[model samples]
Target: MAKDAVLVLGATGRIGRLLQLCPPEGLALRLQARRAQAAAGKPDAGWRLFDPLEDPAALARAATGAAAVLCLAGPVPGRGAGEMADHIRLGEAAVRAGAGAGARVLLASSAAVYGAGSGLLAEDAPLHPASAYGAAKAEMEARAAALGAELGVPVCSLRIGNTAGFDAILGGWRPGFSLDRFADGATPRRSYIGARSLAQVLGALLQRPALPPALNVAQPGTVEMAALLQAAGLPFAARPAPGTAIPEVALDVSRLQALLPVPLAPADAAQLAAEWAGLEPQLRQEQSRR
Candidate 1:
């Protein structure tokens, strides 16, 4: 598959942008987006404007002759049946396209699919999605698993947790977190992973010869929320509620490590918080809002 390449299905998202900036070496890329305009200056020779529901064939073509397909595309939040419908439709289309192209597919899922509780969450954890969004992600995970096996496509489902990439579209000015409270010394324990490290994880997975149809991709450790913020130079209201974990939520990476030579090193909270402080403006505002 030397001539073939890796296709990142969500080129417009935060992770997609980082991938564009530093695509894995030796692997060419096919970046699929909603519109050509969205991809205009981003790096990649193969750019396809695809609608998750209507353009399955085009998407299939894009994946055809590729080394692997990284399904990073996800829903734009707005809630309601319409939004839900959009996410499901796109998810179905992506799975179908990748299967048709006979490409190994690595789907980006969420930790929320595990719902809430406390403890280490293993890859085999029973799902108990709490929110509509979480439910949708769980559904996508199920569908991808079944379809991948049926189509004989190697699938690696990465149920990822909080991915921190401070200066990203997903990290843009939004509500809820602040940098000041952090400045004043407010910390809450939470879990987070860096975009660069995440990218490396994806790259390693793409090069794997075989992976389970589903897996969890996460950092091995957790961090205090307040300390996390302080490291980022941001502030927000403090809370004493201890962090909770969803049992059976960890992605067993032993299989992955065996297949690829690269090591997976998680970026710690201090580093992530520092990065977050430098990049996330809305987080600063949100902290101040409190």
Candidate 2:
């Protein structure tokens, strides 16, 4: 049988940008961006330009023959309800338009869905989102899961942790950056996953026969913010952690590991920093081959 063609929404953003590697052994990527302008300055890498909100026909056309759809296009935090509803709207429209029998849809969700939960978070954890972003994701999961049941389509909400390079510390680094050092002389530790590993997780899920309704995506262990900076060989001043600062946010990936061909291993600061720095070089290589 032929491999499934995966339709990737938000194909130009942080996670979708690396699909050029085509991590999955046999599957093909149907990359979709909101518009051509979002993918400017790059080669015509066959990006399907259309907003799921404005052009269901075009988005459906892009999803044609795709057995899996990965929706990564949506607003970040600090947005209004209208913006947060984009993911929900996109999910209903896309599924209505092109949900083939046995098709599976994966929506980009956040670890923020777990809120201020303590200890390792699992998919079954009750949500008490501390921020608007977290609450939005929780609602997205519930609504999408219901939509999936109604449509006879399988929808999985990926509760993803902080992706390396995109996290607050490394992604927002500057010469005079100040890190929150807690009373224990340690920086805030959060669940972290390398970009390549995340891609691999996606590939693994795409290859699966059936997926759980919700899954946590992350490396096995958490890493400290300051350690990531040190591994990147950057300097920063430390400030005493505020009372509001969170010391750690860990995700339980035991569910994820059981389904993968190879279980995810614990991560180190150096390995993660290298993964972020390597993105550009790999992109250049991909460009050269093109």
TM-score of each model, paired residue for residue = 0.80, 0.91
Q: What TM-score does prediction 2 earn?
A: 0.91
lDDT of 2 by residue, 1-290 (tens): 67678888887676787766645767778788776665566555667888878988887788878888888878878899778877677767655554653468888899998888889888999888888778888888888888788888888888999988777788778779999998889998999998788888889888787889999999999999989999999899999988878889999999998989999889788999998887757655544543
Predictions in order: lDDT: 0.64, 0.82
Worst 10 residues of 2 by lDDT: 94-103
Model 2, stretches more than 4 Å misplaced? 38-44, 98-102, 281-290
- At residue 221, candidate 1 shows an lDDT of 65
Mind giving the per-residue lDDT tens digits that candidate 1 earns over 1-290?
36448888877676776676557766777888887677555344578788766667777778788878887887754477557655555666666777777777788777777777356666676888887777887888787677767777676777776777532222542356532233334433334666666677777777776787666665656655445554655545533433342223334444444555665555477776555445446434433432
Model 1 regions more than 4 Å off: 1-4, 42-44, 166-188, 239-260, 274-290
